[model samples]
Target: MKRFLLHLLFWAVYLLQDSIMQFTWTMSALPGMPDGERIRLAIIATVIIAIPKAIFTYFVVYFVFPRALKYPALRWWLCGETLLVLTALILAHRCLNFYIVGPIIYHNIIRPTSILNLPYLLLTIMDLGFVSGYAFTFKLLRMQLSGKEREKNLLQEKLQTELKFLRNQTHPHFLFNTLNNIYALARKRSDKTAAMILKLSKLLRFMLYESGKGFICISEEIRIIDDYLELQKLRFNERLSIQFHRNIDQEGSLLAPLLLLPFVENAFKHGVSETRFNSFVHIDLQLQNEILQFIIANTTNEDRIQPEQIGLGNVRRQLELMYHDHSLKVTNAAQVFTVQLTLNLQSHAKI
Candidate 1:
């Protein structure tokens, strides 16, 4: 339907421009188009020339345009083809003028029948050039816009694949840590081992199923965080001090699943596990007016202030891909490592 409309519009513009050009030339030659005779002649001439012009327009649009845009090296070949076609069209127009219109309507030969009539040939070529030029410009512009759209789609696909890979990377990093916690309990023959395993199962269900979804509610995400923290608390017992503060005004708000977990996991893995004495992990999450602010700080050994950039790096890259305008900052001051992240929840609402 759209192609039909575009073709219709192209022809309409071509015919209008051709008729105006013919009419102007006829009026200028006769000064007044005397008794409607010149007007009739101009109409006949416009109609006769329109056939070859239509042929050139479609030839370029459907055939030449795509090939030329795709293979620029073929442009010289296209130019040669254009010259041959233009010459043939000019010859055909001259034949129509001399054999049919001139002898029948005006009762006189207008020009020589041969293609070598330089002045008549140039005029015919110029008229065809002007009409075809319109189609040429239109088709070229359409091709450029089409190329841009295709490039955009390819880039989007690449980003999606990369994000999927990153998401996959996150899963194992988390599972490994959770499994270590479970292993520690089993090694100690602790009664909490089976219960932690059950928690791990639930966490797996959320990560495997819900996390794959485009977005999940803040409440669901918070539940996952609570589970994770609880599992960690079970492992560290009285040795780990955990302080969690949350002010969630919009529990219905949504964000990418497991998006905030890496930092939390990072703090637990390095802060509590590596430190020998008085280790603490502090987490604060606040959501108000469609903005979510997350802060996590943990006490680590001075040497381990900056942990290996694996899980946190993955999360940072994910944030960049997911949020256009977001803030993530990591600071290491003495033995305390801090992560600050602010996200526009309104952006997720759009998704």
Candidate 2:
């Protein structure tokens, strides 16, 4: 119903414009006729002439244009056919003017010397061409806009799929390492094994429920890291030295879910686990003015240092997909392995 109204509005506007153009010439041609009568004749003539114009416009825009696009090799033939149709429509316009409008407006059945007059035919062609051009241009603009919208939607879907895949990869990698620790403690018959399993259960609960979200509060992420640290502390006991420092202005700031845990997991797997004696892990996190800066350093034995692992690689890809304004740097020097990450969180912050 709305579409029908729009089309009605378009034709009404076209009739008004055509009536105004015809009124000027009509007033001069039928001088001595009353102004009211001249206006009536002009409007009637425009309405009658518009029939052929409307047909030609719709046929070319709806039929010819689509077929031309579908069959590229037949475009020239379509163009020639369109010209013939335009000529027929112009002739029909002349017949309506000669037989109908003349007798109604002039009260005399005056006939032209030849209905095939070249100049008159050309003038009719120009009038019809103007409206057809307008319709075709509108169609082209709508097609272009729709195409761009579809392309944008497809890109968004692709990015979302890739992010879900990367996020899934982190789950098993993290669980594998944590389960190894639990298995080791169980073999030793240590009492900490049950506590470690409980912590692991909590972490799993968060991953299963909360981690699937697009974003989470920074404080929730901090709580997860704290629980993970406690779990690790149970396994290492007094053998590992761990230190964590935080300076945050807004604990409620938003970040992509599970984005930070992989970094901490990588640090433990590669640095703390590979070293035998005198191992330490230090982590510092600062959030000021919607900018997050995270740094983690761990003591490492030179011979035991391994190559880039899956957790770090997955986090790097996630960062690339999620944040446009962020930086990550990794350094391994002497007996220290360090990771530094900075993120601009203003874009993702909740209002």
User: What stretches of model 2 exceed 4 Å from their correct place?
Assistant: 1-6, 30-41, 105-114, 304-306, 349-351
Tens digits of per-residue lDDT, candidate 2, 1-351, equal 976786788789989988988888766667888888778878987898899999999999989999999999999999999989987898998887677767765564333446677887888889899999988987888799999989988888888888888888899999999999999999999999999999999999999999998789999999999999999999999999999999999989998888888888887888888888898989999999989999999877787555678998898888877887899999977688899999998654221
Give the C-alpha miss distance for residue 28 in model 2, angstroms. Answer: 3.0
Q: Write the per-residue lDDT of candidate 1 for residues 1-351, one digit (tens) a residue.
A: 998898888777767666677667556445644746766776776777688877877787677877888999999999899778877887787787777666665455243556467888788788777777887888778878999999988888888888899989989988998898899899999999988998899999998889989889999989999999888888888988999899999899988899988889999886667788999999999999879999999988867456556898898888878887789888877788899999996664221
Candidate 1 structure, TM-score to reference: 0.86
Error of 2 at 212 (Å): 1.5
Looking at candidate 2, the ten consecutive residues that score lowest on lDDT are 105-114
Give the TM-score of each candidate: 0.86, 0.90
